[model samples]
Target chain A: MSVDPPVVHGHINGQVFSAAADATLLQVIRAAGLQVPTLCHLDGLTPVGACRLCLVAIEGHPKLEPACVTTVAEGMVVHTHTPELETYRRMAVELFFAEGNHVCAFCVANGSCELQDVAVEVGMDHSRFPYQYPQRHVDASHTQFSLDHHRCILCTRCVRVCDEIEGAHVWDVGYRGSACSIIAGLDQPWGEVAACTSCGKCVDVCPTGALFRKEDGTAEKHPHPERAAQLAEARHEHRWTNP
Target chain B: MATKPEPPAPHGLGDSLVERLHAVQQQHGYLPPEELQRLARAMARPLSEVMGVASFYHLFRLVPPGLHRCVVCRGTACFVRGSERLEASLRQRGVAFETASCVGACGQAPVLVLDGAVRSGDPGELPWL
Candidate 1:
């Protein structure tokens, strides 16, 4: 026999919210329709805390934590927005724009990109960090889609989808730190990977223009409209208690 | 030398599947259809939960994978449409061909790109290495 996972109740901004012990802070906040800014965290994949934008102040804890990865507990108090936390989030967004190539004017996902949307959400009108301007090539190998290295923020979204979600572990985070890039099957160029199924799932979940369909055309294409809804349904039905 | 294995990444990265794909497989190599439940536990999610997620997205592969992947789109526009021989042909070739949709290449029709390259047209086709 198995037992249901313990349920935890907590207050977010002073209102009582019910959550599972395993539910992450981000999950809880969003369930209550409260906003917490995030990047590098999508609905389906495991939390990697790579993007520190969702950082929130937890009562009694010394450091802010990524709401997406940090599970909630009984009596836990989380501060979603504070001046210090906002400053930190703003700084992270500034560095993200400065580090790689994020030219919204020339990008495919101009109006629909997550990185750009998050940048706006966090109020980053100007970037203070010096641009790294790494020389990366565009992998237009697949006729169906385009993988631009310059625009890649290395959030590992594409890599995770092809591996965990797609069941074809064809993608991988090739390097570490600011030098990281998503590689297709052992450094084989995009066209060389015999493993890619071309499902375009990676392209769909991408937060930026790093991965996009080839013929998206000069006209901007809207992102997944039902993505959040679909994710909500799936996670709610994730019933794991029948040993 | 004492680092614990990453403990398989939980299922349903949604669009962020690339981040946890290899990390999950490096711990298991291939994802078993039934393991979605265990994966949910690791991610602190539910099973019926991820299975719906696992089943809905084309990005999430449900079958076991080989060291090399051969995705054969059984779409109507592909050259293999009229003939009932494409699946057999791929099978006769001795490579397990996964049935995928659209692949976003309905125009090319009967095109079968290996890895990301079509069978033999040009291995050097794509420049983003």
Candidate 2:
């Protein structure tokens, strides 16, 4: 009848992870330094469980859970990585590859990207499925960064930037399911879209080559979680970002 | 007994460079110039060496993108908010490449993933996801 009290501590792979009652599963495991691949779950933004790649096995749970969304409960058991979970994650990456254009060899993100790293991690040697090949768009109207439709995975980092941060609300998603894509200014060319500020808030957040900066170092350095941990601790204590 | 240095190629892009790149990209992407320069510098070779790689590589972007980008907040918070609207916005507008996500403001509601921190027509900066 009532919700189960949040789990304060959980065991992931037999290792214990503890968090505040309010902490989400991602925070708990990430704090414990476990590697869980997530494309849509960002710390600042709200969790929507849009990307299911971070799914993990919860003991006694009926189905795999999204690590980014599930809140922690005491005495909970979580398995971030398992043989079956790996297969599931691999399939997710494969679908990502199949659904969009992810040519690593020719991508600006080539050596430095999460999707590429995940592909290697989940062992995506080849795509068994056919590419969806949706007619995505590329927007270079802005001077500093560009969006290449061929490489987009429809993750939505840019839309959030424009709406939540820029206060522009310039970016939005159109259509449904596989037909979905990132849009600009009521569905117009970004160059012509009045709402667009040319601020590439979305480019830096992209986990792949779909959105990138024209000026930043072409050789991207994927942000390390250890760095995030340090920053998170610092920020939690009000150190760096505040200064 | 080393040989004399060779002259740099046109536009610092070697011959096979562009051709090989086109083969890899196959009319999809372009190679960046700075990357080429870095390659050349790292090898202690002329800019052509790096440019050649840019031209030769299959996945490089030489010119700037001609399309608009939509970075959905891939961060924990925004991911939970349902970014389908923002993604749909960009696609409906008709960008060739579709929507990709990011934590424009992982700590904030929906921060745009940006190369520049703050510019006019640009979104203000937010913490990284």
lDDT of model number 2? 0.61
A1-243 per-residue lDDT for model 1 (tens digits): 967779999788887899877778888999999998876787767567788988888888878888877888788888888999999999999998898888888888898888888888989999988988887888888878888888787777766666656666566665445656776654457776666788877887788888888888542755552353354455567643332
TM match of model 2 to true structure: 0.57
**Poorly placed runs, candidate 1 (over 4 Å):** A225-243, B1-6, B9-129
TM-score of predicted chain A against the true chain A, for each candidate: 0.90, 0.84
Worst 10 residues of 1 chain B by lDDT: B120-129
Q: On a 0 to 100 scale, what is the lDDT of residue A91 in model 2?
A: 89
